[model samples]
Target: MTAEPRTHRTAPVVAGLLTALVGFTSSYAVVLAGLRAVGASPEQAASGLLVVCLTQALGMLWLTARHRLPLTLAWSTPGAALLAGTGMVDGGWPAAVGAFCLVGALILGTAAWPRLGALIAAIPVPIAQAMLAGVLVSLCLEPVRAFAAHPLLVGPVVLTWLVLLRLAPRWAVPAAFAVALVVLGASAARDGGVTGALLPQLAWTTPELTWASALGIALPLFVVTMASQNVPGVAVMASYGYRVPWRETMVVTGLGTAAGAPAGGHAINLAAITAALAASPDAHPDPRRRWVAAHTAGWAYLVLALLSAALTALVSSGPDGVVETVAGLALLATLGSSLAAAAGPADGRESAVVTFVVAASGVTFLGIGAAFWALAAGLAVRWALSFRRRGTPSADAASGGAERDAEPETDAAAVPDAEPEPQTSTR
Candidate 1:
C-alpha cells in the first residue's frame, strides 16, 4: 500500500501569496481604468480598489469556510472592461454606482431563485470547460507575448519560472513572482525610489438611479459579469473536479458587490483563472488540503486591501506587461488542464472547438461579449450533431433488419437470432 504523504506547511502559504499577487497585479490597473471611465477621481478609484478587495476577501473566506472548498471571489474583470469601453454614462459616476448596485441585486436573485441556479448548474461539463478554455486562451498567451515585446525585462522572469518548473514545480509560479518584483524594483530604483503611504482610504459616493443608466450600464455590466466571469469561474472549478456551491457563491458575491458599490466598487463574482491557482494540485497534493491555500489567499487579500493605496501606486509604477506576464505564467498549468478537459470528449470535440475559438476571438455582439455566444454556439452544435446521429440508422441496425426480414421460417426453432448487447458509455 502507498503511504499518505505528509503535508508541507509552505505549500499553502505560497499558493495563498501567489493567488493574492496574481489577483492584484494582473488586473488592478484595468479596475482603476474602469473607475475612471465612469468619472471616478484618482482617490475615488483607490477607494474603490480597497472596497472591492476587502469585500471579495470576506466573501472568499466565508464561502470557502462554509463549503470547505477552494473558492476565490474577485471583482468582475470583464465587467470592468465593459465599463472602460462604455466610458462615462449619462448620470456619471454616481449613476454607474447605481448600476453596480442593480447588478448586485440581480446576481443575488439568481442565487435566491432555484430555477436560475439550476440553469447555471445544468450547463454540460464539456461545454462549460470549452467556454472556460476560450476565456483563458488570450490571457494565457501573454507570457510569451510579453517576452517577445520586452526581452530584457521579461526574459529573466520567464527563465526563473522555467528553471523552477524543472527543479521544483510547485515553486515555479512563486519564483516568477519574485523575479518580477526584483526586476520592477530595479527599474524603479534606476528612475527613482517608489513612494506611497500604505494606508486604506474610504471615498463614498451616493448612487444616483436613472432609467438611462440602468439600460446603458447596469444591465450590460450584469450580463458580461455573469456570462464572461461567473459562468467560466464555475466551469474552472468543475474542470478541476470540484462541485462548487453555485447558488451560494452567487449570493455571497452579490452581497459583497452590494456592500462595495457605494464606495465606487463594481461587481464581484467567482474568479476563473486566479481561483484555479489556489485550487490546483500544485497548491497541495491532497485536494482536501487545497482549501487552506484559498483561505490563506482570502486573508492575504484583506491585508492587501488595507494597503491598497500603496499597493496601487506600486503596481502603477511597475513596467507594463510585468504583471500580465506573471499572471499568465501563474495560469499556464490551468490553461493546459482546461484545454485538455474541454477537448477530451470525442462527441463534444466540434462544439468545444467552436466555443474555444469564439471565446478567444474576443468578438462582441449587441453589447454582449463573445463568451456567451461561444457557449450558445457550442451547445447548438452539440444538439444538432446529437439529433442528426440519433436520426441516422446505423449499419449494424440495417444489416440486422435485412437479415431478419430475409428469413422465410417464422418458427423460433427454425433459426434463432442473437440479441445485441447493451453498450455502456464511458468518458
Candidate 2:
C-alpha cells in the first residue's frame, strides 16, 4: 500500500492580517469593559490597551518563531477585566503593572519548577473545559441580547453568518464580519453619520510600578493569565498537533510580560480559541507551511505595538455596536465547544455535574474564581469514590480465605516497577 503525500501549504498575508484583526477586535470590548470597571480615565485605559496589544503580538511572534508552530500570545482578557475592577479601584496603573510583574514571575516560576508544571498538566481536561465554559458563557450572550434589541440590523446578519458557517466552515467568520461591517457602514451613512469613526486610537503611557500595586494588581493578574489564559493557550497548540515544550513557551511569555508590564501590559500568555483559528486545518491543511502565516502575524503585531496610537485610533473610531456584536458572534462556536467538552463522559456523570455546576455558579473564595473551585470539588469527589471502591472487600474474598490471601499478591503485582538506582562504587 502507498502512503499519501504530505503536501505543504502556506498561509496568505491577508489571512494572517485577518486573524490578527479578528483577535484584536474580539477582545477589544473586554479591554474597554475592564478599564471602565477599574476607574481608569479614558486616556489611561487607551494607553494600557495599546501596550497590551503590542506585548501580546510580540509574545506570539517569539514563541511561534522558536517552535515553528502557530503559537498565539495574547493579553489575558479576563485578567484585564479583573485589574480594571480591583486594581483600578484600589491603586490605578501602578497597582495593575505591579500585578503584571508578580503574575509573570509566578508563571516563570511554575515553568522553572517541574513539579508544579506537572501538577498543572495533570489537571483533568473536563475540569479545565468546564472552567473555560463558565468564563465564556457571559461573553457569548452579548450578541444575542444585541440582536434582540436591533433585530432588523443584527438578526439577518447573524442568521446569514450561521448559515454560511454551516455550508462553508472556513469562510464563516470572515464573511460574517464583512457583511456586518457593510451593513453597519451603510446604516451609519444613511443616518448621516460617517461610519468610519469607530477605528482604534494610539496611546502610550510610561510605566509606573509600586509595591502595593504589585501585590494588589500584579499577582492576581499573573494568576489569571497563567491559570486561565496560558493553560488553554497551550491546549490550542496541542489540539493542532504542535507539541512544543511548555518551559520554552512559558519563558517566552514571561519575557514578554516583563518587557511590557512597566508600560501597562498586564499579562501575556498563549491564545486558546483564537490561536486555534489560525492553527487548525481551516487556516491551512499543511502544517509545515502554516508557519509563514504565524510569522506574518508576529511581524504585524510588532508593527501595531510600536505604532500604538494609529491602531488605537482605528479601533476606537469604529461603530461600537457593530464591533461588539461581531466579536460576540465570532466567539460563539468556541464557547459552546469548550462547555460541552468540559462536561465529560456519561459514566462520570456525577463528577461532571459537580464540575459544571461549581464552575458555572460564579462562586469565588479567597480571591480565586469558580473555575479553580469547580476542579477542586470534582477531583475530591472522584478520589473519594475511587478510594471507597478500593477499600471495599469483595464478596468472593468473604467466602474463601485462600482467595483473600491471593489479593495482596495480585495488588503487589499490579504496582509499577520503579527505575533502578545508580550504584556508588567503594574503592
Candidate 3:
C-alpha cells in the first residue's frame, strides 16, 4: 500500500520531466536561430532563451493551477523560424527587440478585444495549417541538406535519429541531441580547448523601434505566432476535450512575452505538440490530476533556465550546419503532421497550396516577409472562390443573407474533437 502511494507521487514528476525534455529537444535550436537572425550574440541569445523559458514556464504553471487544466504554454517555435528566415534588419538586434515588444502588445490587444479574438478565430484552419507547413519547409529540409554538406558529422546524427525512431521513438530526439553534442565537443577538443564559460549570463538589449523593423519583423512574428502556434495550440487542447479559456491564456502569454522581450527573448505562445504530454490520460489516470504534471513541467523548465548559458554554449560550439541538422531532425515529425493537416480536405486544397508555396519561397517585398504575403494570398484566394461560388453580383446581392449562413464555422472553441491519441514523441 505504501509502495502504491509512492508510485502515484512519483508519476507526475516523471511526466513533467518528459514534457520538459521534449519541449527543449525540439525547439531550443530554433530559438537560437531566431536570436541569431536579429544579430544577437551568443550571450544575448542565451539570455533570450533563459528569459523565455522562465516566463513561459511560470505562465504555464499559473494557468494550469488556476484552471485545474493542463494548459501548457511555450515559446512560438514557428515564430522563431519566421524570424530566422527573415534575416537581419537595418537597426539589428535592438530593432528586433522592439518588434518583439510590439508583437506582445498586439497579442495582449487580442485578449482585451473579443472582436479581435473573433477575427483571429475566423481565419480558416486550412490557411493556418498551410502557413505553418510553409514556415517549416526550409528548416525541415536542413537535415537532408546538412548530410549532403557534412556527411561525416550530420550523417550519424540523422542515422541515430532514424534508428531510435524505429526502436525507441520517445527517446529519439533527446538521444540525437546528446549524440550531436558529443560529436561537437570532440571536434572542438581536437581543434583546441573549447572557449566560453558555461555559467548563465543575463544580458539586456534596449528597444530601437524602426518603421521597417516594425512592419517587416514584428508583423510577421505576430501573425505566425497567432496562426501557427496559438491556433493549433488551442486545437490541441480542444482535441483532448479541454475547453481552455483561450483568451485568458493569451493574455498571460502576451504579458510573458512583453516581460521577456527587453531581455532579448522573442514571442511566447501556446504549445501545440508538447501540450499533449501533460494533457493526455497517460500523464495521470485521473484527468483532474493531470495539471500536476503540467505544473511540474513548469518547474522543470525553470530549472533548465538556470542552465541556459551552458546549453547555448554547447550549441554555439558546433558548426552552424550541424546545429541546423540536429534542429531539423527534431522537427521532422512536426513538419509531417503540419503538412498532413495542410493537405486535408478538397475545398481548401488550392488556397493551402498557394500559401505553402509563397511562404516557402522566402521572398521579401517592401520590407515584409513571405509569411505575411502567403497569408494575404491565401485569404484572397479563399475570398475570391467564395465570391465566385456565389455567382454574379445580382446573385451575390440576392443571396448575401444566405451567404452569411453558408460561412464556415468561425468559433474555434466550439469545434468538437475526438480525443487525440498520444504520439510516440510529444512532438
Candidate 4:
C-alpha cells in the first residue's frame, strides 16, 4: 500500500527565520566586500546591507505567501562585486543604481513577453552550469585560506565538519557552524578580551542618484545580477519541481530592488544554490513541507536586518578564522558537484568551457560582463551547427534506394514471423 502524503502546517515565523539566516550568513561577506571595493564608508555599507537584507526578506515572504512555494530571494553577491569593482571605474553608486533600474525594467519586460522568456530559457544548460561552477569556486577556496591563517581555530572546525558530513549529511552545514561558534566562544572566554567585540550597531544611508552612476554602475550591476544570478536561480526552482511564475517573480525582485536601492541594497534575485540546500529532498521530499523552512528563514532575516548593529557586532566578535574556514568546508561538496555537472557530456563540453572561461575571465565590455557574453557565444555556436546540419540530405535519399535507411533493424528480425503458420491437421 502507498504511504499517505504528509501535510505541512508549520508557522510562517519559523520559515522566515530559516530563510533569513540562510540568506544572510551565506552572502554577507561578499556583500561587504563589494561595498568596500566600491569605496562606500563603513557606516554606509552597513546601512546598505541592512536595507538589502530586510527588503529581500520581505520580498521572499510576500512571494512565498502568494505562491505557497519555497521560493527564496537574495541580493546578487557576484553582481555586487562587479559593481564595486567596475562602478568605481565608470561613475560610482549612482550609475550602478540607474543600471539596476534599467535591468529591472528589462527583466520585467522579458517576463511579460513569452517569446523573450522562451529565448532566455533556451540558453544551453552546460553554459549555465559552468557559470554556476565558477561562482562556487571562490566559496570552496575560502576554507583553505582560512585554515592557512589560523590552523588552531579552523582545524577543529574543519574536523568537526568532516565528522558531521560522514555521519549526517543533512545537518552538515549547521552542525559545522555550531561547532565553530562553540570553539570561538571558548577561545574568547579564555583570552578574556571582550571590550570592543560586541553586537553590531544601527546604521543607515540615503540613496544618491546620478546619470554617470547609472551608466557605469547600475547597468553592469543589472546585467550580471539578471544573467548570472536570476537565470540560474530560476533553473534551481524548476529543477526542484516548483512551478512558480517567472514574470511575477521578476516583478517582485524589481519591486524589492526599487524599495532598497536608495538604502544601498544592490540587485535582488531568486536564490539558486542556497535554495537548493533548503529545498532539496534532504530537507524534505514533500515540496509543500519545505515552505515552512523557507518561511522560517525569511522571518529570521527580518529580525537580523532590523537588529543589524547587534548582528554585525556578533559577526565581528566571532573568530573569522573559524567562521570562514567552516563556511568554506561546509560548501565544498556543493561546489565540487556543481563544477562536475557543468562540465558534463562531451557534446556540450565546448559551451561549458566558454562559459567558465568567460565568467572567470573578469572581462567587461559595453558595461556588460562575461556571463552574458559566454551565453551569447555558446548559443550562437549551437544554432549555427544546427542550421548547417539541416541543409544536408540523408544517405538513403541520395542513393534513391527503395528501402528506407531510417527503418528500424527490428523490422528485418521479424520478417519470418510476418508469414502465418499453416493450419493444424486437427482443424
Candidate 5:
C-alpha cells in the first residue's frame, strides 16, 4: 500500500529529470558557441557553462521553494545567439562581460519600474522576431556549411536529427548531439586524444564598459531576452492558472544574472517551453506537487553543471564544425518559428523583411552590429509606412485606457497573459 504512494511521488521527480535533460542537451552547445563568439577562451567558455547552469539551478530551487509554484529559470539562449551574431566586440571579452552586467541591470530596472516593463512590452513583436530570425540565419546555415566542408562528419548528425524530429520532436536535438558525440570521438581518436582541463574552474575577467559594446551588445541582448524568454515565461506560467509574482521573479533573475556575469554567464530568465513541461497536468495530478518537479529539475541542472568542464573540454578538442553543427541543428526549430512570426501583421511586414535582410547581411557600421541597426531600420520603415496609412489613431489610447479597462480584471487577480507563445525561445 505504501509502495503505491511512493510510485505516485516518483512521477513528478521523473518528469523533472526529463525537463532538465531536455533543457540542457537542447541548448548548451549554443551557449558555448555564443561565449566563444564573444571572445571567451576555452577556459572562460567552460566557466560560462558552469556558472549559467549553477545560477539557473539555484534560481529555480529558490523560486519553486518560496512560491510553491513551478517557476523555473534558464540562461537566455536568444541572448546567447545575439552574442554569437554580435561576435567579438571592440573591447573583446571584457566588453562582452560589461554588456552582460548591463543586461542584468536593465532587467532589475524593469522590475523596479513598471513603466519600463510596459515599454518593453510595447515594442512590436514582429520587429523583435525579425531581428532574432536574422541573427539565427547565419548560425542556422552552419549545417549546410558543415555538410559541404566535411560531408562524412556532418551527414550522420543531420540524419539523426531529421529522423528523431519526425518520431519524437522533443528528443531530436539531443539525439543529434548524441550522434555528433560519436563523430567527435572518432575525430579525437584520429587526432590522438582530447585536450582541455577536466576539472571545473572559474576564469574571471573584470568587465570593461565601452560605448560600442553597450549599444551593440547590451541593448540587443536585453531586448531579445525580454521579448523571447522573460515575457513568454510569464505567459506560459499564467496558462497554468498560476499568478506568477512578476516583480519578485524578475528581481531574483536579475540578481542571479549580475552575480554570474563576472564568471562569464550572459543572462538568466524564466524558462518558457520547459515551464510547460513541469507546470502542466502531465507533471502531477495535484498542483502542489508540481513545484516538486521544478525543484527536482533544479537538482538535475546542478548535476549537469558538474559535467560542464568535461563537456567543454571535449568540445574544444573535437573537430571543427562538428560542435557548430550540433548548435546549428539545435536552433533550426527556433529559427523557423521566428521567421514565421516575423511574417505577420501585414502593415509592417515589409519593415520586418527589411530588418531580416539587414541583420542577415551581417553588416556592421561604427562598431555597432546589424541587430541594433536592423531594429532601427525596421522602426524607421514602419513609421514611414504608417504615416501614409492614415488609419484612425488606435483602438485604445495607451496605459490609461488599458488600466481603466483592466481594473476589474486586476481586482479579480486573474492572470493576464499579454504575450503570445514565443516561437523564438530556444529552451
Candidate 6:
C-alpha cells in the first residue's frame, strides 16, 4: 500500500496550487486578448480576466467536493484563441456578451439532451487518448523551446525539477514552479518590481441580441468550446480512469458561464491539460485521495482570483517562457502516458496515429480547432480499416460474427468517461 499518512499530506496541496498557477498564468493573457479582439474596452477585458478566474474557481470547487473526483474547470483557452482571431461584431462587446450567454445556454442544453455527450463518449479509447496526446504536443514542447530561447533563465528551473525527480518525486513540479517564480520575480525586480493595479475594476455590459452577432460570435464560440474543451476534458479524465457525471458537470459549468458572462467572462468548461496535473499519479499514489489535489486547486484559484490583479501584472511583465516552462514540465508525465496509450492495440493503432498527428498539427478548419477534426479523421480511418464483406465472418478464435462487431464496446470502455451503448438489431 502507498503509505496513507505521508502521501496525502502535502502532495495534493502542492498539486492544487500548481494547477491554479499554471492554468491562470499561462492563459489569462489569451483571455484578455480575446475579449479585446471582440471590442471589449481595457476595463472590460480586465473584468473578463477577473470573472473567468472567479467563476471557474467556484465550478471546480463545487465539482471536486460534490463528486469527490479530481475535476477542474477552466476558461476555454481555445475559445478565447478563436475570439482573438475574430474581429468586432455588429453589437460590439455587448453582442459578444450576448454570444457568451448563448454559449452557456447551449452548454446547459447539452446537459438536458444527452445525445451530444453520448456521441463523444462512443468514440473508442485509443482514439480519445490519441486526441489527448496530440493536444499536448504543443504544450509539452514549451520547456525545450523555452530553454533553447533563454537557457540562462529556464535552465535552472528544469534542472531543479530533474534533480528532484530522482531525489524526491512528488515535489518536483512544485519546486520547478518555485524556481520559475524566482526567475519571474527577479525579472520583475529588475523592471520596477511588478507594478499594476492590485484592485480589479469590473465593467459590465447589458447584452444585446443581434442576428449578426449570433452567427459571427455565439455559434462559433459554442462549437469551438464543445469540440476543444468539454469533449477532450472528458477524454483526459477518463484516461486517468474516472467517469465524470456528464449532466452534472454541464450543469455546474454552464451555470458558471451564464453567471459570469454579464461581467465579461466567456465560456468556462472542463480543464484538459491542468486536469492531468491534478489527477495524475504525482498528486498521490491512491487514486481515491487525488481529489484532494483538485479541491486544493479550487481553493487555490479562489486565492488567485483575489490576487489576480497583482498576478496579471506580474505575469504580463515577467519573462516570456519561464511560466510556460514550468507548465510544460508539469505535463511531461501525462504526455508520456498518453503517447504509450496512443500506440494502442494492433487493430486500431494506425487510426490512433492519424488522430494524434492531426491533433498535434494544430490545424483549423471551418473555425473549429484541430481536435474535432482529429477525432473525425481517426473514426473515419477506423471505419474504413474495419470494413469487411457483409456475409464474410472475420477470422478469430471466437466463432460468431457477433463477437467481432461487439469488440469496439470493449475497446471504447478502456476509458470510461463515456460508456458505450449495447448493440441491438432486428432482422
Q: What is the C-alpha RMSD of each candidate to the true structure, in Å?
A: 11.0, 8.9, 5.1, 12.1, 5.3, 7.3
Q: Model 6 off-target regions past 4 Å? A: 1-49, 60-103, 193-196, 201-246, 261-300, 366-368, 388-427
* 227 Cα displacement, candidate 6 (Å): 11
Model 4: lDDT equals: 0.58
Please identify which of the two predictions, 4 or 6, would achieve the higher TM-score against the true structure: 4
Q: Least lDDT summed over 10 consecutive residues: which range in candidate 6?
A: 418-427
Q: Report the Cα lDDT for candidate 1.
A: 0.71
- Model 1, range 178-229, lDDT digits (tens) per residue? 7787887787788786655447788899999776567657765765576556
Candidate 6 structure quality by residue, lDDT tens digits, 1-427: 7556865688988998988887876566557656866888656777788888888888888888888999999998767755654557766889889889988887887777655444544666677667767766776677899899999999999999999999987677778877877888899999889766767767788988676566656755665576556766777787788877777888888888988999999999989778999999989888898898999888887777776566556655687777667766765676677678677566557889998898787666554446667778998998876664233445333334553675555454432223331111100
Candidate closest to the true structure, highest lDDT = 5
Q: Where does candidate 3 have its weakest 10-residue lDDT segment? A: 418-427
Q: What's the alpha carbon RMSD for model 1?
A: 11.0
| Predicted structure with the largest TM-score when compared to the true one | 5
| Predicted candidate 2 versus true structure: per-residue lDDT over 1-427, tens digit per residue | 9643333233445556667766665566566545544445455555666777777777666666776777667777756544433424235555555556667776676666644444443455455555555555555666687787777777766876789778986566666666765666566556664423233443344445555555445544554565456656655666667764667767777777776666556677777656776787756767765666666777777665554443333334444455456656655675676667655344334665676677667555554445556667877875675465457656334434653454343222211111111001000
Per-residue lDDT of model 3, residues 1-427, tens digit only? 3344666667777888899888887778888887887789999999999999999999988998899888888898878877776677768889989999999998887766645655665666667667767877888788888888889988788888889999998888778887888878877777674656688777988998787678778876876687667766777776777777766777899999988999988989888788889888778777788888889989999999988888788777777677777777776776787688777666547888998899889887876667778878998998887768667787567656653653444325212121122111111
Measure candidate 3: CA RMSD.
Answer: 5.1
Task: List the candidates ranked by lDDT, beginning with the highest.
Answer: 5, 3, 6, 1, 4, 2
Worst 10 residues of 4 by lDDT: 418-427
Find the number of clashing residue pairs for candidate 3.
0
Assess candidate 4 and give its TM-score to the true structure: 0.66
TM-score of each: 0.64, 0.66, 0.87, 0.66, 0.91, 0.65
Check candidate 1 and list the clashing pairs.
none
Clashing pairs counted in every model: 0, 28, 0, 36, 0, 0
**Model 4: CA > 4 A from native:** 1-41, 64-89, 92-103, 178-242, 271-297, 314-327, 330-334, 363-427
